[model samples]
Target: MDSATRVQESRVFPHPINVVWNHVRPADFKFWTSAVKETQVEGGLPGEVGSQRKVTFKDGTVQRYQIVELSDLAYFITYEMIESNPPIKSSAALHTIKLRKITHDNSTLVEWESDYSSSGNETASVVEDSRLKKKEALQDLAKALGSK
Candidate 1:
């Protein structure tokens, strides 16, 4: 038996948590160009739990994801691969984004986590890869929001 990989990362932004969550959740796939192609939501809205959405990769591979958990401004979202293939037989991926409001016109921190341990492929480095890519995304989000 092999253990799966768990990857997590967080960043502090100079903006409110709600602002960070807005870009990361509502425009999920559009959050980063390198990680996703376009997200096609089939169920409820972004903040609602139990909602289903299809995340299409730049390579055209699609992953059906469901919203398993949610909160007012702090929440966790999970994406389980309903369909499987060769490298990834099946996987349970979760992304948790927590927002902390610092002040009325000050900064906030955005904590992010992504776990892909249920994939069952210990040798695969997809989780690690995603972590690196996510760091860049955080920077992008910061830049994108700071200008607005």
Candidate 2:
């Protein structure tokens, strides 16, 4: 399987690592998923690793994700859709979100990525399209978090 389509954007926020994590981690999700009427469950503990949650969209699309790595608030989370309303066939694909802290006085930079086999051409296109929307949503999230 070839690498999945990738789209990434990062922003620096003027907030502490945990503060930034607290603001961006789940709250930002609310901005993204809630807008589309999707809500993510609260399952992860602050600064702990291996925590997880599920997100369900208004259309009944669902993805189960977990925090796979952590470094004192900086971390990475991964996910693959377990179910969807239209039934995503490329269930083998994976998405990873990396969060890194910026040293310049209480700030953090975030990176979001998705990967999967090349056979998922249609899924790749859709993922590409959604990445743009994600970027827009992230921007809104930053603003809402008072990071902008």
Candidate 3:
């Protein structure tokens, strides 16, 4: 692969920054992302950098990731997948999430972006599939936050 393809999605949540951040934490991922059936912290503190986790999906796919960056003051977090299963295989998959406080009604704007290269030859298929999955995950997040 030449380089990793990037996919980005964003949603507005009608909740305060702190409240939205609470729901966006890795510990609460399974609640908002349907693909994430379960998650177990592998090492270190939950929200701290270098923390690792094993995420099991509903389809029985498992992926391991490490927290590469985290900033509470900036409301941002990033993860690098160190291991992955088929179809979405990647040696350097990166996921970044950013939250911006929207002054109107104390809402929040959340942006999620993922960059990865497929290990298989089906790069386009993998990218499209990931896009759809992330879209659903964001919708789920909005619903979980009680946003319309």
> Candidate 3's residue-wise lDDT over 55-114, tens digit each?
888899888889999888999889988887643555467889899999978889989898
lDDT of 1: 0.64
lDDT of 2: 0.59
lDDT against the true structure, per candidate, is 0.64, 0.59, 0.81
RMSD of each: 3.2, 3.6, 1.9
The order by descending lDDT is 3, 1, 2
Clashing pairs in 2: 4-116, 15-106
Which regions of candidate 1 deviate over 4 angstroms?
73-90, 103-105, 118-124
Clashes of each: 0, 2, 0
lDDT of 2 by residue, 14-132 (tens): 66566655544552266564445655554666334455556665656665656555444346656554445555545455566667777766576777666644454576566766677
Q: Please give, for residues 33-95, the per-residue lDDT of candidate 1 as tens digits.
A: 666778777788765677777777776667776777766634344454454323453255666
> C-alpha displacement of 143 in model 3, angstroms?
2.1
Error of 1 at 69 (Å): 0.8
